[model samples]
Target: MHSLARRALHTCNVPRDLTQVTFCDSAGEHPDRVGLDGNAAEAVWRSVEALYRTGVHPGIQLSLRYRGEQVLHRSIGHARGNGPHDPASLPRIPMTTDTPICFFSASKAVTALLMHMLSEQGLVNLMDPVSYYCPEFARNGKRTITVHQILSHRGGIPAIPRETPIDVLWDRDEIWRLLCAAKPVEVDGAKVAYHAITGGFVLQRVLEKVTGDTIESYLDRYLRRPMGMKWFTYGIAP
Candidate 1:
């Protein structure tokens, strides 16, 4: 019965051949340019291959640099289809080195950096209460929450209210309204609860209030363009 079940499972959900899904930009790899021997580079790539075999990530991209030169730039797996539960008929989209992926929580680092930049410019004081910039944030007993507290995950507004719809994340105005209206879990900055999504919107409001500009425009002008980043915006353009 065990052997029969194994056969049935394999027949129903056949694993994809890794070679069939792997894609690489041959021109982008230049180990010799960085003085890295081919064997060493291949060894590193083999580790990435091992990770891909684990089936945790649907897609993976690697751009390793050595001595300021690109030694390996490669990608593996589908960007869209080929999930373990996906139907075989679903069309697969190859995850290329150029494919754009969501940075998610990684963007918090950029947001925090921008806030520090604002401080350096004398536009904001990290220790000051957020209400000092955007008075609307003072609603719901959050008047004392400082910008530094928010950046450090002590803003007291950890998760959004349980009743808030998931769709609110995409609606800037609605999300801001909800965050402003929601009450805090605590306000002394004595706890270390993660803000998750709330701190970002709060920080954004403070930023926009002080700069008189949208965060997206600010990021593009100050960081993305200056650094020649191809895709580092808040959202992908449709």
Candidate 2:
């Protein structure tokens, strides 16, 4: 195995007992919520505890709602500084229910939902090529890639080129330019390679082009603000 892979495996093999030391419970749980009994809620929490004991994840947070009421809102382990590979001398930052965790790929689901919502509003048709909305994406033989293909991980451009700088991610225009210029592995939507980070930008561009607004503003106006979310955003606020 590669040295880094071996190190990663070793780091993930945390002792079961260490979970107890690292565990931090949030005070936000509402076991007494009318439909949920304390015992039933504890059963669910115990299941979460069992997963935590496996030590694969350094931290976890859960907010489970039952019938429109939040029955469980809790977190466990360290958000930082207590990874299995870290030395014991480091100070642990306790994971809390309020911790600003990155949704990462989970944001893709939200983006997908937004796309469906846009379709419902007659903003863009899912089956239409993305180039129909953002003509720049038509470059480099991507002219026929549909919004649906991108949403489903079938759009051919799965990743940015290896030679690209990591910092280019924050430069939206530059990243889009690279994506526009990238050759597709295939454009027939016959494969299932995941786009990972690339699809989000493509979807964002289409959304912005159709709405004449930034994706963030569109999300805020349609979903975040209306849903009363405190911090479900693309990036952390400074």
TM-score of each: 0.75, 0.81
Model 2 off-target regions past 4 Å?
1-34, 226-228
Task: Give all candidates' CA lDDT scores.
Answer: 0.84, 0.82
Task: Give the worst 10-residue stretch by lDDT in candidate 1.
Answer: 6-15
Candidate achieving the largest lDDT: 1
Q: In model 1, what are the clashing residue pairs, if there are any?
A: none
Clashes of 2: 0
Off by over 4 Å in 1: 1-20, 29-44, 64-71, 120-122, 165-168
Largest TM-score belongs to which candidate? 2
At residue 15, candidate 1 shows an lDDT of 41
lDDT, residue 227, model 2: 49
Judged by whole-model lDDT over C-alpha atoms, candidate 2 comes out at 0.82
